[model samples]
Target: MASIVAQVGADRSEAAWLVSTRREFKYDLAGELRIQLYTTKCSCRRAITWRREADIPDWINQGVKVEMETTTIESSEVKTAIARLREKAPFVYGLTNYVAANLSANVLLALGAGPAIGSAPGWAAAFPAGAGAVWINGAALMSSVTPDELDEAAATAHKAGTPWVLDPVAIGAGASEYDAILASLARRLDAVIAVSGEVDYLCDPAGRATAVPGGDAKMPQVTGTGCSLGALSAAFCAVVDPFTAAAAAHVAFATAGERAGERATGTASFAIAFVDELSLL
Candidate 1:
């Protein structure tokens, strides 16, 4: 006999609905209610059975217990699948010299990714072995941190076989240095994951971005359009194969951004709404 388990809201009778049974069966829900049934080629019937396990074991050992009572069997396979996807969650590293960078990191965590924040050259080595993807934000640059640090970090992530996402906040908005840094990182990395209207350097692999034109425009203005992109990348990296992860991340971000727009009036509103909407995804 096979068992199908689902959440509280699912239909329990579907087990037999599509199957043609030669005999009888039972079902259980939350270990309380039991429904027993008998089926023939021409008709089907059900009756209540004993609520205790001892009474059900008589038919259980014979593999007919399923036909004797109605207890819900939780499907462990679905849990296993979710776990397997989670096992691949990316070790997200953020490099920025701005306080806003902290907000970006928090965004990653809120979206269900593993986030590491710091701009130390030492962090570069950790990228290859520990993370599935890296987010490099050129928002606030430290002259003490040479441009080579960005190059080395991107290169290390690539060598470690992880994808790197670059967030060049306000690149052309007079932050020429930031734009240059973004471009340099983009050229060094195998492929870049960037947001729209930022540094127009990278081509998104379709499903890798999370920003759109509508909504409050408040959240996007506050968090770099790249913030959602990075978080979405992190989320998809947890659930899918590399190729599809980029695409899935983009879809998730875009949909949520659009939804956030509908419910928000500005960045502050979007910030609150964005978090609320993520759980929906």
Candidate 2:
């Protein structure tokens, strides 16, 4: 499914619109015009031309109530947010796994943010002192940091009023205990929980959620995608609210992954292309 929305009047003509090629239309509004085209294949290049105003259904103008309120961030809004993030150049501190540390740092830097990877006994507690945001990757800490130390670090970040992002890598894949620990930490701080998979899900402390879909299938074959997302989320948090930050990171990475996949032949090349695409953003 794909959708295009446009206002019927000249007064609102200049207002921006959102184009989504997803399976569902979720929103919280009334009297909005939605033109949906159903296609068996999911392709961004598929075009649906609108000829005239009479082509629109009469019920679309009559108005309807939607129980679910889903907001798709406009491309313009994401562009503005990306520019703001580049201008702010906030410092993002990460506690990522060894496998993803390098890529995570590079991704943060590519997005025009300062990256600091620290996992010393007390580094997490001290790093966030002057950092714009903190990122905690449990996959990396499984061997490096103790549970108590990780808790202390999260507590320190919470007390310092710094926004943090938690990436529960492999949340439902035989990591129930670890998942609970991260979930508990998420509730204690102003944090964004980024759960990466075929469909990335981001949720704020208040339980509001955003879903980002559309990425290369090779994403799972590559290492550190989740970790890079966590770092990018922190980078975005430096300039925007946690929810917006998470959503932006998701869209940016997913979009970049798709572009990178088109140019690369294998995992190694895809990884390189992914970073290049991120920098171009």
Candidate 3:
């Protein structure tokens, strides 16, 4: 599935298949299924709609009130936000002490979007409560966040009604603990706006994600990591709703990966250049 998304994120029709497939699995038999697509002036340049009924297409065409709320942010506003982030410095707090997360956060700032990278449950609650958006990168397990901690963070983000982006980094990596934490968070948080990952260890009933073929991008396994996707998430959340935020973020990264792969460069340069390129997209 990750391979499919990585390959198809740039191709609208193919990407739609992944969205619809995931929606069917995620929603189960609970609702009617309908799929809609939108055009956005962003890195990916496309949008997707998934409904659980046969009339969804008609509803979308009719501008049904329920489905009309999803919006695509103007490129200018995105540029404005990116410009704001460029001025502020990003601070980091998480289990994974690796500089990549911090670097990614800064890149997000450089491109646009204020970032708060705290894993302490208290800070997590406070940040998302007031923040316009939030990104939870489970890349670093950091002594295994308790169920209570994950719940508190998810709850705080949910209550604030802010966009929540979940990055289950390296779930397929050696850390079973990280995967466990992600599972708990997934079960506890019913309203995850969007999620991105390298492996398919976990996913929503909708199963919406844009993944890549492992080890093909030639980065140190740290290049173009969660930070890029998280930044893209921030981009959408800053302008659009969560679902759109998630979809756009996923597509942006996937498209970037496709672009990067086309060049066959090292991950470090690819990751850095990718952020700059994606922001403009």
Candidate 4:
């Protein structure tokens, strides 16, 4: 009576199971799927394939045919995303920290996107509905707007069906407020970025996660780079799907950063070169 279930999304589908009892793989047959993992996050990665009837794994129902294929974000899609972003010049509304706001706006301008920073009363709910895309930085929310405004902005963005990216900044260790904000936004999740060192995991609501790896060694030395990246993500999201947009932004920024790094001697000069590189691209 064991069965396999697949929850399908627009671009991807996934079926996962708990690693049972250190000795077996358990399957349920009650016409309901239950997911419980011993570990919070699975580090071991595997390919899901059930090619032919004879090749099917022992755990799977042999009579059932599981169609599995990984659809990744291609370089061509990145190129298309860039082209569309420049063509559309998406109006990006950002709720970013004051210290980084100017630089973030300059970055968006160089990338051919109109950037607007919002902090005024009633701006959160109104601007997102009008923007091509929105980026909400938790650091900015903590300093500028009231606590409830972040929820309002996220809800408004979700209700408007606008593509928005929430940059959690720091996940833990002194960022409990940010984590609390994310916990509240969980139900209204659209696109979220997961960073593991230089590589970024762009994840969509449907569980489609793509790893886009690209960055310069000196890129972190500059100020406002992270904020700028979030705004760039918003601009790209306006033109393409969230996953592709995140990939394209990372790719684009890396390309610019690498070029700038090669030309500049110090972080101060590299910052200037980075903006110049973005515009030149």
lDDT of 4 by residue, 1-281 (tens): 10111111111101111101111111222323222112114454333233323443343332222122222334788778877878998888887678778878988999789998868888887997888877766557446565466556655766676666655443221121222222222212222423323444343334444554555677766766766776787788688755566567767776787788899999899889999988877
**Relative to the true structure, how large is the alpha-carbon lDDT of every model?**
0.41, 0.56, 0.38, 0.55
- How do the candidates rank by lDDT, highest first? 2, 4, 1, 3
- lDDT per residue for candidate 1 within 1-281, as digits (tens), equals 11110001001000101011022233333434444334334465645343433443232132111111111112233233234435655567656555455555655655556777666657666664467556554433442444556556655755555555443332221222322322332232222323233111222223222222222335446544454454445444445543234434444444556688798877788866776665454
Model 2 local distance difference test score: 0.56
On a 0 to 100 scale, what is the lDDT of residue 219 in model 1?
40
lDDT of 2 by residue, 145-202 (tens): 5545545555566667666654434323212222332233234323344444445544
Instruction: List residue ranges in candidate 1 displaced over 4 A.
Output: 1-87, 140-144, 168-216, 234-243
Candidate whose lDDT is highest: 2
Residue 280, model 2: lDDT of: 88
Q: What is the TM-score ranking, best to worst?
A: 2, 4, 1, 3
TM-scores of the models, in the given order?
A: 0.50, 0.64, 0.47, 0.64
The candidate 3 region of ten consecutive residues with least summed lDDT is 1-10
